[model samples]
Target: MGGASNDSSSSTTRCGVFELSIFVAAIVSGTACSICSKTMMELHGVGIDGTMELFTKPIFQTFGMFVGMMFGLIMHWAVLVLKIPFPGYEHTSALDNDQRPGYNTTSTNYGAIQSEKDQLLASQASTASTSNATPVWMYFFLIIPSIFDLGATALCMMGLRYLDVSIYQLLRGSGIIFVALMKQHVLGDRLFFFQWLGVFWNVVSVILVGATAILNSNDDVDLDPNDAFWGVALVMAGAFVQALQFVFEEKVMSMEDAAAPPLLLIGMEGFWGTLLCLVVVYPLAYYFPGEDHGSYEDPFNTYEMFMNSNTIQWSFVIYFFTIFAYNLFAVLVTFMLNSIWHAILDNFRPITVWLTDLMIFYVITETGDFGEPWTKFSVVQLLGMFVLLYGTAIYNAPNAGSLKLEGQWYSFGFNLRGEYEEIELEIHEEELNREWEERQQNFKARRTSSLAERSPHTSIHTQALRGFASPKI
Candidate 1:
């Protein structure tokens, strides 16, 4: 009876292990959701901004998007030739798996639930388990974050008119703390104590920086009606949107079956968003005219002819480069975060990628460009960087831990010769493990049916260790 019970327990554990593997697969594609954010930002910033004048202006965004993508493709090709350093590969310890556990795979899912109940249940069902019905709102949850993110971008850009970069950074950095609440309450994931500490430290840094900016500035930077409140509102909205996106993706969007490829989603998003904004904003501009009636550019300069006409001031070139660097970074980081096995650990890898863009932006500012970097580093400003760093580390820590707990989802930590090679090896490993486990179960059943109850098999012990073991050592 005892032997029979053990077999049942082992079968249950095997099922759970399979379910977790699926969850990890889904989480990997969650990065595709960022296409929605990117599309929304461009729509509001350029599409909706000049509103009405653009209708006669020609549907240029579609073309501009294609052109922009061409540039991105060229850059990607160039980077391949240049062999640009991808940051994650350099920093991640190849031997972490080998050093910690004894598994052949210690690098798979980052947020594997540690509880036995979750594991067993996960093995038995798909993501939409009968125990917890998926919230109906989940269908539109992705859209909610997109709207807020666009709002944030517009607000921050507008806030820039009134506030200095230092002030804006302070406010912007504060967004992550809101994320901690989302992660805990919405996603129901229990973060480590240090992770909370890291978040607190980051938020405190932003507050301190803002206080310093207020104390030092002799004048308040205020803007016109169109620019003031709406700008601030947008950025705050963006922050909330960002926080919401992370939580929703973790809970609902990150599933094993993906709906579309990254570029396909990005393309559709850009096309739809541009069309929708034009439809909504153009009518409003027609009757309740704002910047729509007459744009800053000349009358003949329709959106269609804007690029060909020499109407683009040299100053806008500076802006284009800034956009070029920032957008490129944003798009690439999104791709990397999506493609990886344990994105949850480096959860805010997007933030780090954004900061790198900011640093590049600072250089543009320092060269007496349209952008300006703040000269004096207040104590608060310095602390914000530290907090950001710690927060990123804390988020990533659990990813490693999760992989340690679930051995079924391990990835070869070493960088492969090519993307195809990497994928093939990963699949091969999974198949072999499945066969290995089946054989072991068969051996155990044979031993039991013969009625000689045996001790725990060494192979079984080793296999369990492999689930938790490090890949490198």
Candidate 2:
């Protein structure tokens, strides 16, 4: 039983290591979803009237965000309150299963009931923790990052109107630099020499890409040098806010109890973020009407766009649904991985979006023969892409180990190498020693009882012989 138990645990850890690929796919899917929404806005003319409607509509854009948040809220309730499992995510701790007492996973019906009952207990415990009157300031602190995140996202939407999604991804790549600095200063994280080199490379690549976009506009798409400059600036500003949001999220998650439901926490952020955006959207609509190009035809047209046009209304439905699913997946990844790796994984966004655009153009849209900013297939852009890839590789390389890539899922402390095995072996040895000692003690007790049982019979036989000899005398 002990050996089987150890084997089960080891297998679970191995499965977790394998699950890394699934986690990456989820992140990529979420990123692609968001990129697709941005592209739709760019194509459909979300910023046409300088209003906020999606694809040149302002009211619909805000509605889409709200609708997405609603989806997030519903998912959180289902997972955290209703105790329903997320499809394809039924195994949250495939690698780090802690088999608690009363949790018998071997039986389907009874075990499921037990698991749900335990989950209810956990939920009640979390509620009790909240009822203990957590400091109001802590709640505010938790919420501040969500506001910054929303602000950054708004800027990103506006920037998307001017810059191609690929270039915008390149510009936002500088997020690694800010994240590194903040990790060092605010979180007391120490980077190794290679990690710092990676950071340096990231900075250089960002500069290369940004300069290429701004100075060399001939082969680039719709961007003049002037527009490119401002677009890059807005993206950088958004990246800055995004950096703060990442750091703040890390801090809040760290402070949360181990038993707390991460999705619930994320849902709270989305709920509040949507409310905050409501307060900011009107002023944003007035001031940012596409920065001189997409001025709104009428102030009330933001609302009128949905009521008047069926196509626009359907687009909102798609946009909101996509954004909702994206957030759910992204938030799960965020909770499982730290913000650092989260940002790192996001480097794939540009490549994914670029490929997606290529597919769309060649098959669906049938846009003009691919060239310039529209296709973003120019040699200079390709060079920038290579640089970005190189930087990301250098940055995520193992910290201080041998050249052999030692993969570790830090969230669960599971390692893919024999190092974890070595530790487990030591533990197995200790268990064996304990069992051996118990076996020896049990053997000695059995031997002593048998000897005692024979001694009484032997003494009686000796006494009978003595009596027979005395009677003959």
Q: RMSDs, each prediction?
A: 16.3, 17.4
Off by over 4 Å in 1: 1-149, 164-170, 212-233, 248-253, 285-369, 373-379, 398-473
Residues 176-235 of candidate 1 have per-residue lDDT tens digits of: 566666545544434444445556665665555455455445333432444434434544
As a whole number from 0 to 100, the lDDT of residue 332 in candidate 1 is 30
Each model's total of backbone clashes: 13, 17
**Candidate number with greatest lDDT:** 2
Tell me model 1's lDDT, rounded to 2 decimals.
Answer: 0.36
Return the TM-score for candidate 1, rounded to 2 decimals.
0.45
For model 2, where is the 10-residue window of minimal lDDT? 464-473
Per residue, candidate 2 scores C-alpha lDDT tens digits across 1-473 of: 11112121211111133235545665566556655556555433233354454444433354456547556556655753453544211221111122221111111121222344345544654454344323445545546766776777766666655666677877777787888777766655555445566677778778777776775555555557787777788888888888887666655544422212345445666667766656665556656555334543233545554555566566567767666665555544444445665566566567776666656666666563321234334456667777777677656543221121244442134234453345356446745764685466345433532212211222222222111111000
Task: Tell me the lDDT of candidate 2.
Answer: 0.52
